[model samples]
Target: MLHNFTYVLFKLKLIQPSQKAIRFWMDCEDTDKLEFALKHGNYKTRKLAAEALEQIAKPCSIPALLNCINDKVQNVSVACLNALERISPNDELIKTIVRKRFNWVNEIREKRAKYEANKHVKHTIYRWRRTSKESYDRVKEQLKKPIR
Candidate 1:
């Protein structure tokens, strides 16, 4: 009865899905749903989905995580970075790429002054943000059919 009620609420879109809801989807090994949440959910939900992807550690999730690694929200971006770090350690190229992103994320924070003043990293961050959003939008359009 409780499950049905929540399902009805979700179907009606009465409230945007919560992080815990996305976590449940993760436990079901529903990567498609996680990808959708990572793109569409608020920062909290996106972070949760990224952490879930980290735990699930599937190669299929890398693209979705990459799409959001430049998230404007620090928490969400860090979560994505962590997910990418764990998911692709065996792949040298991807590991190097994620390391660069991890550095970029750190550089923007004033607390980490090492590269914070680097103009090149600052510009790259903005460019990556735009590129990531565009790719996410494209994927979102292609997946127009609702999740089951």
Candidate 2:
């Protein structure tokens, strides 16, 4: 279990809490190590590591997470996607989904776009005519329904 690296890592004042720590994680190079760091590493550690590794858009970590896509737990895939998306948005996995127009990704993006556009329109309308709580709730509830 690489306990030496893990334990010594936290205690080292030599490495600042930000970029230095991230570089250490990146140097680990092993996708398994990176994945372990991502899952078990502290939030600031994970977030910085993901961001740093992302700018480089290393391909190693992306494939590691791809295998996790089919994980039974929904959040596992979501987290995998989140990490992979950060690491490399243009990576094949994302591009494949974009190219294929996978229903899941397409629907989610479309729904989010629609909701944002609707919210802007509603906000403008509300400025002119004060929206009732009931009316706003009805609109929001209606938007929540799955598209046929």
Candidate 3:
């Protein structure tokens, strides 16, 4: 009962505790509490929860960690990624990450194409300028010597 109350206080911001303490509590094998913390806790708490889940290495925690992979906080996402790696996620998680990776690659390609298209003339001029001076002079002389 006291443990539950302390947890509630922690959740409600009535108490601020160290991440080590939170990690110790999570090691008690309460997946529900760990999941809740992962989903709703502050970044540090979420990170600790992910580490605890990694230490537990329970397959059941895979889904929760997978869901956290897209967390806005980089630390939380990194922790979740590390936890997922340690848990040896199932095929679904692998497929999801692959799909997301492909989508990200496609997006980057599209953006690069757009940028290139927009700057094509500038790129050509820059490339021409970057050539060796001898090659540039040869090209200039060739252009000056008009065809018969």
How far off is residue 55 in model 1, in Å? 0.9
TM-score of each: 0.65, 0.38, 0.57
Off by over 4 Å in 1: 1-14, 111-148
**Could you tell me which residue pairs clash in candidate 1?**
none
Q: In candidate 1, residue 66 scores what lDDT?
A: 86
Note the Cα lDDT for every prediction shown: 0.79, 0.56, 0.76
Ranking by lDDT: 1, 3, 2
lDDT by residue (1-148, candidate 3, tens digit) is 5567767887787764457566666668877778878887888888888888888888898889889888887677777877777678466756577467446556867998998889856543444454588788999999999799
Q: Rank the candidates by TM-score, best first.
A: 1, 3, 2
RMSD of each: 23.0, 15.5, 10.5
lDDT of 1 by residue, 1-148 (tens): 4433544565566755666676677778878777877887778778888999999999999989988988999899889988988988888877887889877776676555755556456443443368888899999998997888
lDDT of model 2 at residue 60? 73
lDDT of 2: 0.56
- Name the 10 consecutive residues with the lowest summed lDDT in model 2: 13-22
lDDT by residue for model 2 (4-66), tens: 455456556333245554566566654454555554555555555445445545677766556
Which wins on TM-score, candidate 1 or candidate 2?
1
| Residue 47 lDDT (model 3) | 89
